[model samples]
Target: MSMRLARPGTSDKAETSPLAVRGLTVSYGGDPVVFSVDMTVAPGQMTAIVGPNGAGKSTLLKACLGIVKPLAGRITAWGKPVARQSSRIAYVPQRTSIDWDFPVTVIDVVLMGMYRDLGLLRRVRPQHREAAMACLDRVGMRDFADRQIGQLSGGQQQRVFLARALAQQADLFLLDEPFAGVDAATESAIIAVLKALRDEGRTIVAVHHDLSTVEAYFDRVFLINRRRIAEGPVSTAFTTDTLHEAYGGRLSDGFTARRA
Candidate 1:
């Protein structure tokens, strides 16, 4: 894929750090979920956060996106605090989080990403529509632009959400389980888009659960279980030791342990 130009105001001299998290900790219902964690996402890199079920991987992503407030520590994007630069980040939640019964067409859902830039009183201009369509095309979902979101298959729905994130045109992209329940074809398509984004100097971080795909799909991997166990290039960080520490006997035991 051809590299896209960097967003305006991002200086050429600026170090290409897309996200920085320091001492991040989160709690749910007053119970600690994600412990103090430090992580950084560099431009043009695909970073995957992996762990066992209830390992706080999803919570970590949410904390970075500011959807779930962190009890302690800081998160910055493009050198600015996340709370101050929310527009610079786009997030695609787990597919199950969306209400499939909601009355909305594919186009409508994709257009939601543009609401921040368009504001409440303003209408979606032709430029906005064109951009949204282009995003859908990039994800190979242009043909489904008018279809009802609920009627589409799981993979199609994922593509639509990804297209919506593309339409947001943010500097950083956070995705939760983009591969879950997706068919091989859809998974390939999604990975291609992610690779394109990384090649274009965008930072893409995903909460990924499939250990088997880590080495194949990501440039960097973070193994976490409440706290970080290891983080670095997949080859260096995704070791048996780290897996054992992060997932305990579960990862080594088999699917049952991993799922437990």
Candidate 2:
């Protein structure tokens, strides 16, 4: 199948952009990673960041959240700096980053999402626990709420983290490789929840690796290989050429021949 651009949904949605980045440049030890990239995320859509490994897709998300200091440029959510609107954004990190042996229960981890609203030194009320349990149910993990995190399988652990993100009820969700190392059941469950959230007008930006699923899973795409290659609707931007550029010599022919 040939690659083409999606209809121009991304062009006329400036008013709906909850997340906007301009002239963004990030570096580590004075070595540049992401170049000057300016992209606007339309509200209520799933935006996937796709590129070769080590191309800094995750770094771009971190820069948006002010977690990693950028040497240049700026990011804004809802026309305000992310630092000021942190409460409205939720992030689901890759499962590998989590410490399963930390002695936290499934529900306990989900409750962490509410601590921001609970405030410093404020006690977690019983209602907070109730809300967490509700989120666990949404992810099909309610039955595992009291279980030790380490005891769960890989997919179960992934679901637990997703439950935590859902409990946040944030307008914007930035997910890092939610599909990585997960079973098909877990992937199906997570995508179902994400689609439901999008139908509710919540914005989701995910760092995605599977090329074949891009068009099927996400509405928009951002292709990066240290520099932005394309940004727009999945059909329009996820072209063979863009993938080639982003992946460099790393893209497999099997994937290129397969259409999204």
Alpha-carbon runs more than 4 Å astray in model 1: 1-16, 253-260
- For candidate 2, give the lDDT of residue 199: 98
lDDT of model 2, residue 140: 94
Give the alpha carbon lDDT tens digit for every residue of 154-223 in model 2: 9999999988998888999999999999999999999999999999999999999988888889999998
Measured with C-alpha atoms, the lDDT of residue 36 in candidate 1 is: 76
How many residue pairs in model 1 have overlapping backbones?
0
* lDDT accuracy of residue 54 in candidate 1: 94
Which whole-number lDDT from 0 to 100 does residue 50 have in model 1?
Answer: 94
* Top candidate, metric lDDT: 2
Estimate candidate 2's RMSD in Å: 3.4
Global lDDT of model 2: 0.86
